[model samples]
Target: MRQWLKGLALFVAITCLVWVGVLWYWQATSRDMSPEDIALYLGLLPLVVFGLALLARWALRSAVASAVAKEAAAAQAPASGSPALPSAGQQERHAPFKLLASGLSCAAGHSAREVADALKEGAPRPAPDKALRDDEGLPVLCARIEPLDTAALQEAWDGVCAVAQADLQGAEAQPVAVDEAVQRALAALQAPLQQCLSQLAAWSERFAKPDADGPQAASAAVPAGLRVFTAWPTHWSPAERAVAQAWVKHCLKQDSADWLAPSQLRLMPSTQGGGVALWLEADRALRAAQREGLPEVVLLLSCQSDLSDARLGHLQREAALFTHTMPKAGVAAESAVALALADETWPELPDAAAAPVLLHRAAVIQRDKPIDAAGRVSAQVAEQVVQQAAAAAELPLAEVSALVSDADQHSPRGAELFSVLVSQLAQLDAAEDTLVAGTLWGRTGPTAPLMLVALAAHRAEMNQQPCLALSVDDSVARMALVLRPPAAAGAEPTKTAS
Candidate 1:
C-alpha cells in the first residue's frame, strides 16, 4: 500500500513539472497567442496547484506508514505472550520483594494452617510494581481480602464472642473463673477484628453507591455480638424476632437452641425503680413486706437500670422482704452448679446495668440538626432509657444515697438493726469504712477496724439471735455484733438474702 501511494505521488509530481515547463515555453512565445488561449491557461493553473498539494500529502503518508510497520515488527519480535507477563525467571527476579508481600499477607491471615501452607508452598503476589510500597515501606501487594466478603473470617471472630457469652451462661463452657475467662476470650476474639474492619472499609469504598448511608453506618459499627437488643417504638416484632434468631444462628452458630427461641421470651410489664425493681423481680417482695409495708407497688419487675451505690441499696431494701418460689443463688459465684440455673423453671432476674459505654466518652446531639449521628444509638438506647425511667421514679437524690449507704452496711435480713447502728455511727470518720465493711464484709481493708465491726454485725444478723457480747470500740470507731443460731432450729437454710 505504501509503495503504490509513492508511485502515484511521483507520477503526479512529474506531470506537474512537465506542465509548468511547457507553460513557460509557451509564454515565451505568447506575445502572438490569441486572447482565448490566455483565458484557458488561467483556468488550468488552479487544477495544477491542487494536483501538486495532493501529491505532497500522498508522499508524507507513505513515509509514515513504512516507519510504523517497521517499529511494529521490531516490537513483535521481542514477544507478547500472555500480555507479556514476566516469565518464571523474570518473576523470580521480583521474588525477593514479592515473596515478602506473600509472607505478610499470610501473616495477616494468622491461621496456623494458612501460614504453614504459605511457608511450605509459595503463593501469588499482586500485580504492578507501584503497589510494592505501603505504610511499612515493605512491599504490600494488593492481596488483602475484603472483610465483608470474608464470611469465614467474620464467623470465626463472632464464634469466639458466642463462646464467651455461653461460658457466662454455663452452657458451652465450664464456669471455673467465669468473669475472668469471659474477659480473656473476648479480648482474644477482638484482636483479629481490626483486620476485618479494615477490609470492610475497603469494600465500602470500592462499591460505594448512592443512598447507602444506612448500610455504611451498619458496616462501620460492626456490632460486637448478636445484637440482641432493639430500640423502643420498635419492639421485637414477629418478623424482628425471626431476624434476631437468624442473626444468632449465623453469628453464634446457635440454631434451634432454646435460648434463642421466641416462645421462651415473655412480654412482662416494664419494671420501675432504680434497682428496686430488680430485687422485686428477684423475689425480695416477701422481704420488702417484712421490713417496709408493701408500699403500693406499681409493677412487678425483673430488671433494674441505674446501678449507682444508692440504687443498689434501694434494691437490697426492697429485696429483703420480697418472696417467691424461684430458686436463689449468689450473683458472683465460681462453681457452675452454685451459680444461677439456665432452665425455664429458674426465676429470671434483671441483668445488671451494662459496663459503662467505652467507645465514645460522651454523646452529643446538636439541637438544630435533624439527627445526631454521633449520639444516636441503635441497641443500647433502650437499656439507658429504661434505667433513666427507674431513676425518675425514685426518691430525691439525698434520700436515695443515705438509704443506699445504710442498706449496703446492713443486709435486709436485719435491716432495722443495721439502720440503727448506721444512724448512731454517722458522726464518726470511720463511718465510710464501716459502710464499706458491711457492703463487702469478707473483703475489707487492713486499716479499717470500724469496717471489721460492721462485718461482724452482718454475721450476727444472719445467725438470728441476740448479740449481747457485741461491743463498739470508741477508741478505734469500731462496733461488733455477735450471735448464735437458734437452739431449736434443726438445720439452717443454705441460701441467704441481702
Candidate 2:
C-alpha cells in the first residue's frame, strides 16, 4: 500500500510539472511570434510528448507491479483461518479410488464381454442414411442407429439399468421440470460446502451458481454419491429445455442419488462424454472423503441423434436454420451407452463379470486454443493431459495395452487424435488396434463417456493389460482416463487332505 501510493504520487507530480512547463514554454514562444520560435515550439511539442510517454510508463509500471504482487500474495495466503495449502511434494492424493466392477450397454453390446467380442471381431456397422458429410459436402457415412426418440431412450435405459442392477420405481413421469431435486441436493451439501466451498467453487461452477432462494434446510432426500446433472442445448426453446432438465431428475429418481453434471455437458460439438468425465474426476479429487478402502463408482453416458424426427428428410432446412454448418460437415447419429464403475471396496461383484480394471488417472484441461477445425487436437493441452496421466500412474507410455479412443477417421473427432498420438505416445503407431467406441457404436450422445470407460475396461480384460482413453471436446477441453488391469493373482494354496 505504501509503495503504491508513493508511485502514484511521484507519477502525478512529474506529469503535472511537465505539462505546466510545456504550457509555459508554448505561451512564451507564441508571444515571441518568430519563425525560429515556431520551429522551436514544434520541436518542444515532440519532446513534451516523449517525456510524457516515458513518465507514464515509469510511474505506472511500479504501481501495476505492486498491485499484481499483492493479488498473487493474497491468492496464495490462507484467508481468515482457512486450511493450509498442500505442500509442493504432496503429489499423491489421500483417497485413491479403485474400480470394483463395471456395467455397459451400447449398440455394440449389452455387457463388457459382449462389447469386447464385437470389437475383437470388428463388427462395427456401416453408417446408414447419409449420416455424415465429407469436406466436399458429399455424404460421409457414420455409425448410425435406428431412431432415438423418447421411446428409444427409455428402452435403452431400462435394459442398461437392468444389467447395471439399477431398479427404477415410482409411476411413469411427465416431461415436467425437475430443477427442485437438483436444488434440494445442493442445499443438503451447503453446510459442508460452506466450510470449504471457496476452495471447491474454484473447480465446479455448481457451488458458484447463484442460489437466489437463499437456502432451504438440508433435505433428507439428497444422497451423498448420486449427482443429478444435465446439459441442455442453449438454443432450445423453454419447453425443450424444461424436458431436458426434467429428464435428468426423472432419471435420478430411477437411481435415487444426487445429480451432478459438468458445464461441459451443456453444449459441445463433440466429446461431451469426455468433457463430463474430466469434470467428474476433478470433483472426485475435491471430495472430503479421503477414505482409501471405500473406493469409487462412476456412471458415464453419451448420446447423439438427429435434431428431430424429420431430420433425415429436412437436412437442407436444418442446415439453413443454424449459423454453423455442422449438419453439413458432421454426422447426425443416435447412440446411448450406460457404464457402471466401482472400485475394490465393492469386491462382491459377480464372478462372471469382467475383472475389475483400475482407473490409474484422469485429467481435464482448458487449452489456449479453442477447437475450430472440428475435433482436431492441435492444441498442446491434450498432449500434456496424456503425459501427466502416464507420469502419475507410474506407467510407461510403451506399455499401453490398447486405446479406447474418439479419433476415428469416419468421425468428426478424427481430426486431432493423430496429432495427440504422434506428440505424446512415441511407442504406439496411430494405426495400432485402437477402439473408437463412438464410431463403432453409432456416436451415442452424452452417454459416450460411460461407454468408452466400459470399453476401456473390456480392452484391459481381453488383453489382460491396461488401456488409455482419450478425447478432445470443442478442441479446447482435453479429457483423458487411464485404466490398468489388476495384477495377476498368485498361485492358489495347495489343497490339504481332509
Report lDDT (CA) for all predictions: 0.27, 0.47
- Give the C-alpha miss distance for residue 96 in model 1, angstroms: 78
Q: What tens-digit string does per-residue lDDT give for candidate 1 at 85-171?
A: 445433322111000000011111333233223322434222222323322343322222212133343455444445435533545
Runs in model 1 deviating more than 4 A are 1-157, 160-275, 284-435, 438-458, 461-498
- Reference-based TM-score of each model: 0.17, 0.52
Which lDDT tens digits does candidate 2 get at residues 358-441?
675476677776554434346377778787766655567787766777544543356567666666666665545576654456
